[model samples]
Target chain A: MFQVNADVIAKEEVIPGVFSLTIVSPVISENAKPGQFVHIACNQGGNFILRRPFSIHRIVPGKAFEILFRVVGRGTEALSRVKVYDILDVIGPLGNGFKYSERITSALLVAGGLGLAPLLYLAEELTNEQVKFYPMLGAQTKTKLLRYIDFKRIGKKTYVATDDGSSGHNGTVADLLNRTIHYIRPEIIYACGPEPMLRKVAQTADEFGVKCQVSLETKMACGVGVCLGCACVTRQGYKMVCKDGPVFDARDIIWDKEEIEPTLLGGYRCETAKVSDPG
Target chain B: MKNPVMPASGTFGAGREYSEFIDLNCLGALVVKTVTLRPRDGNAPPRLYEVSSGMLNSIGLQNEGIDHFIEHDLPYLRQFDVPIIINIAGNTLEEYAQLCREIKGVEGISGIELNISCPNIKAGGIAFGASSRLAEQVTAAARYNTDLPLIVKLTPNVYNVSKIAQAVVYGGANAVSLINTLVGMSIDTNTFKPHLGNITGGLSGPAIKPVAVRMVWEVAQTVKVPIIGIGGINSTLDAIEFLLAGATAVAIGTANFVNPRVMIEIIDGIESFLRQRNMSDIRQIIGKVKV
Candidate 1:
């Protein structure tokens, strides 16, 4: 939990509404772990009040760190305005990250759209460890896919799926998983994507008797666990995503349907665990 | 004696939330959220709604109760040198007394702030806050139970806040904190309906600052006890206005949502202003009425 003023070294529009920001923070870059995030204070002293949380896409050793995100709302829109050399107040390397085990020789990486951010670092780490990586990338279209060259360079076998059949396999990534699960026979599966995608992966992994870990996203207030705003339903009960986990074993989550139903207002209903008290 | 900056209860939590971005020890003091006899789940979803310049929240004082707080939060709070003001709310006089009695021996707790103005829950919610008699009774009951300094938190929705402040003071309150979030409502323009799940909620932010400052001035002139002013205090200038209006201390509330580091910024701004004004100490500006 360190606050450092990071300078934007590079900003690139990877796809429509999607961007990749490279910030020069050696301290954060050297310490960041896969699945952890940095809270980027956008437009300091401006109207954008809260800091935007972004998953660390890739940590470039001692040089800098990268965050990939989509311009979903005002916070991200303000972040998109940031240019090269613009200083940002960032607090980071926060929340528990994926615990990579050396016993797992073969690994499966599943990603949907921008969920690919955190997995990129895990992929790099896996390659460094000489672990077999089977990367399953998903996007609405070929244009939405990111870091294609990087994945191709490192992954032992990279599979791609686009919803519109614009490129790669003409199906969802889950459909591709159904076809490739037997061939890869991965020892462990790691996934970060839409809840539906993660649910499908979780169910599939359970059926195949393979261990699975998932990263969840929730509405957060204090990213340090005090607010209890970013809580999720887990097997044990309610657990704060910012503290107990952003990453949890798929079997550990409760995944209640009624709680996750879309609210009358357009936004998703907060599916926080039904804790007796939130303090 | 006056113009101390304090963190709003519940709004500031235990200060650990912002420890990542700002140092909690630098602030004058911090007010932890209202604790109860038992853990409370609080209100349902849609507890918060954004209005023009402020927001309404029906958080309902969701806390881990007194016992859990004493065991878990107090030990962590003791590490900070700044004073820790514990805020406690109760459904009955006995409950309030029991809570006070329990905190009497707590080592880290510097003071106790009686939350007499929670609008979210139906229990002892607005009962103690809406009347001068009940406020006095609860304050006196709490005073009898504990030897710690007591500050009575006043609701802004009352008819005459000065009367209520005076009542709490007479009841043996060491201090008074004014203008707890005002009762407010917001409508969804499209649905033509109330926005918040609780329908009515407490409003806090820059929108209510002026009202809060006026109330602080009114209560300051009438009550003998120290006043901690709160409402929409997002900056040092805001804090200064409350001070000039007669607040011994000011609490930062809704601004935490807008920017987690706003408290540190206000502290720095106040220090800078003091240096620029050639003031030697913070006490010089506390309640120094211009007229």
Candidate 2:
């Protein structure tokens, strides 16, 4: 809950339209967990009112913690204008993050686009626990695909997919899952990606009788869950994405494409499904 | 007195959600939501939008009304040690007086802050705040209802806000808080449409701090009562600017959306600034600048 003006230590263009920012915040670095994010105030002292939420990419153990994000919207565009040593007002390690369970033996990680940012740290945590990792990376094109060398270095095996035929397998990440799920046969799956991709993955996992968890994104007013801005329909009814999740079991959610009406329900809607009775 | 950082109405609920992260008692004061005569559902969706260095919100003063607040929120808020400033809004002058009288004897209630600046609804949207006569009439009505310190909150939308400040003072306001969120709009260029559900919303955050400071300075000079400044206060320096510009206290609004602990930080920042400057009392800094 501390508001610290962090300095940008490094910045890199990971790919076109994708840039990574590393900031210095010892408070955040020490307290942050996998799947947790920081709300960064960007561009000339609060010019952009809402703080952009970025996953704790890798907490470099130094005086400051690091957050990795792509230049996605007006907030990120303003973030790129920040220079080294320039201060950023950051509030985070916010929201309920992913839980790392010791009982899980093997892990299947899935990501699409910038959603991969949080998954990278989850992989790192799993590696420390000596859990076997099956990582699937997806992007629209080869150019959009994140460099996989880091995941390859630690993961047991890594699969890559792209929508356009410019990368590893000419298919969506879900297509890759359909082809490989039987071979890998993971005990538990953790996925973050577009709602459609995650929905399909959830369905596939349910059919296979395997447990799956997903990281949901919503337009958050108070990332701490006070405003009820970021809410998702779950089996229990409306749950605050900022508090109950950013992470939820795939089976727990009620997916509805129509319910996901834009601007009406935090800029994203899903009306096709409702959370089944929690009982 | 302690640390001059208070939460804006409707922004910081009864301080229940904030207790998990920080101590609510450390704040100078706690301002509850704008309570009406009855429970309000608030405005439609798209209640908020991000503007340049600021954000616009049309929450429409949504709350469970005065009776519900007195029965529910007041009991919970009384547990805290800090003063409670009740923000009251109404469609008519009699309604305002009725609501004020209802909370007049509540334990732990330190004062009443008349919310005459909310622009999200039509019935009273800048109606009382835009003119000195209306502002005075509302202030007088609320003042007659309560013996507690009456703080009239002035809107920034009016021309010569100082005149309204003066009117409220003459109407028997013990203090005044200014400026409330500035009215503004945003457009989605791709769809060529407005961004918020209310079409136009009140803007708050760092973008409007300069305007708020100017208004606070102007009102401070014109009115004899204390002035509590609000708008775009995200950091310590911003808080200092408000105090130097003639604010007896400051309220943190939109920054609460970005960081919930912002009020706590501003409180600590003020103390640190005072320590660094070798000042002991906070009053030494308040209204130090006369321009």
Candidate 3:
């Protein structure tokens, strides 16, 4: 991994509180892989010392990369206020990312809100590899949704899920996956979203006999393995999310506890209306 | 010595994680995580709770034990020319002595930082550091087993830290490092629940630097041993502040996670700081604060 002072190339407000920041970090971008993330310095060693970790949303290889995040914490709020010429100390191409298998012909891409960040890069890579992929995009409402249009430009149609039923399916993408996973039956499922959604996805994929990979998030100090603070519980005991993964096989994750649910509108909201899709 | 800049124990793992980003030989010393007598799984998920300026981590001294370190980690660390200081923690008094005896047989380790100040674990972590009697007993137990330069890492949770520093010194500690993370807690504004899995954690980063400097100055007054000051050190000026407060050296903890090059930058900045002041050596600034 390499750390570089990247100059902000562009900043755009995707939604009201959501931002897409593009930076000229050739070293990181060139070395980056899909599902791997970069640690962005929101402030110097002032009020907040930990650098905010963001998945590589998109890459302009040999030139730049983009990170998509919502104004959830004070750190992201500080990040949203940055202008074009500002410099950010970014350390990246960190952690193990998604690994593609040649045996796979079809795959299902699932995301919840900003969870779409890393999957967007994954989609582009899959497109280049001539793999047919279906993306399940979820949001609270139509305006709050992200990256479906970006997925459309790559290939195929996106399966949209909105909590308010403003879009395709009238529920979480996990609920949608349960409903249609049998009919669609992609070779493997890849997901990144709220923990509750991931739990539901893992369960659905298991029942349908589909392999899955998930990108997990936690309260991390070092975006490397040094601190061992960001522990992701799995069948094989505790693993460091920063080094062992931001990505892992979904079946291997032991998803217990109530951290967050469908994560509607970037808020940790718990709502349950799950009907096991008898598909 | 390359420079008086090293990572605080537990904040830095076996030097393998950062080996990709930095050369291990550039450090004044290499202090690994707090190794225990047995393998510890550490705390559950959400081991970290970030606050305004720093963070609270209740990692609970998670490690693969000293046996794993000797078999797995020692060979990789042997390649570095830097003096390796293993940070050892134990669940009991005998465990501390046993760990010292085991590490003494290892060829690469130059010193031992007895971690009596870890606030997360239950059995005997901060209990020993908080009480002068227990601190003295633990320090002596470690010293009796090995002739390694013993540095007792002090916590800031005590009422009078200087008393404990004096006790450890009297018990045969060669030097001291202050302060380990302060005992702190955080509650989620939304959930109204404790943020960390251990409910409370040790606070570290720039937030605790002032407390660390004050403790270093206090402990420096009570003992003649060299003090390695650690707390919220992020820049060269922060490191220099510790030295002026009577710390012979400083260890950077949370800042290493922010910018991996922070230690290197501080080394370069300190050189320039001395050059600007027309000083030839770092000792000129150590405890040189004007009254």
Candidate 4:
């Protein structure tokens, strides 16, 4: 990963509290894989001291890349106001990304809320790789279902789910997958979203005996995996989400560590993973 | 030009993560995270929160035991030509001795840094370092347990940091690393609650530089051992300030998050500073503050 000052070419609100920033960084756009992420230094003038981790939303090799974010806290709010031409200190493409396998042909792409960030790039790659896939997108409301058109433009079948019933399916995206998994008969599933939806999807994939990969989100201090702040417990033990993976096999994640409600976004609850045996 | 630039323990994991960005050979030493006798789960979630000019983290010293380090992490770090210093923590003096005994004769290790400054753990962390007597005891126990060079790390939360430094040196420490993260806390105005999951956390970054410099300056007069200054050291100028304040070397901590290559940049900058000044040795300028 290289640390470079990327010039913001475009910054626009995709939704009310969410934004898309197109950055000019050839090195990042050129080497960034589907599941890799960028750690962005927010406006230093603001109260932000930690670099915010964002998944690469899109990449244009030798030129630029795009990242999507939501104004969840002061750091992101500070970032949303960044004007075009403002320089952003970007370090990426960090963390292990989605695993590419030549064995899988039919795949399922699942995204929730801002989780659509990484999956957008993954979909582009799967399309290029001649992999047959379906995009399943979900959000709290229809207005929050981000970039559905972008997924559709890939000329692949896309599905939508929202809690308020304003969108295509009136339940969680996992519900959509459950209803369609049989007909779709996907050999592999890649997901990025709220922990609860991911947990449900992981469980469904397990029952269906399909391989699943998930991208997890956590409050991280150093995106380079030093601080040990963003550790997630797996059956193997504690692993840094920024290093061992921001992406992992669904089977490896210790789903019991976190209790996520199927439909409640804010009802998500998780505890830090314990070090099983330090020795 | 032996410009000693290493990453502080806990801040630089096993040097695996940043090694992908910068060459490990650029550093003077690699101080791995603190390992206690038993595995520590660390604190609850919300382990870190960004402050105004720094961050508050209560990671609670989460690490695999020293055996895990010897069996797994040590081999990976040994591939680099640089010296490796294993930082160790314990709940009691015996535990510290046990850790030392375990690490004794371990290949690829050049030194042991006794961590008596972790603020997050409830027992025998900052507690031992807060008092000169306890600090001396732990330092002496660790010193007696191993033949490796022992560097005692002191906490900034102490009332008389110089006393602690002197006590550790007298207890047989070969050197001392000063000004581990200071104890601090922040409250979320919106939630009317503490920001860190541990309620309070250790603060680090540019905000703590002046205090760290002052502490190093004070400790320099009390102890004869070399001082490894740490706290808010992001640049060569920062490292130079510590050296002038009586530190022989400085470790970069929080800045690693801002840019993984910061330590390398600081090393280069220090070398350039010396070359431009035509200085033959770094010792000529160390502790030369006129004031």
Regions more than 4 Å wrong, model 3: A258-279
Clashes of 4: 3
TM-scores, one per candidate: 0.86, 0.75, 0.95, 0.87
Q: List each candidate's DockQ score.
A: 0.17, 0.17, 0.34, 0.32
**Positional deviation of B71 in candidate 3, in angstroms?**
1.6
Pairs that collide, model 4: A278-B64, A278-B65, A279-B65
Ranked candidates, highest TM-score first? 3, 4, 1, 2
For residues B111-147, write the lDDT of model 2, one tens digit per residue.
9999898888777637988889999999999988899
RMSD (Å) of each candidate, 1 decimal: 4.9, 6.1, 6.6, 5.0
Candidate 4 lDDT over residue span A16-63, tens digit each: 888999999999998999989999988754445778999999988789
The lDDT values for all models are: 0.81, 0.80, 0.88, 0.86
Fnat of candidate 4 is: 0.43
Ranking by lDDT: 3, 4, 1, 2
True contacts kept of 3: 0.59
> Which of the two, 3 or 4, has more TM-score?
3
Window of ten residues with lowest summed lDDT in model 2 chain A: A265-274
Q: Which candidate should be chosen as best, given lDDT against the real structure?
A: 3
Candidate 1 vs candidate 3: which has greater lDDT? 3
Q: Model 2 misses residue A130 by how many Å?
A: 5.8
Return the top candidate by DockQ.
3
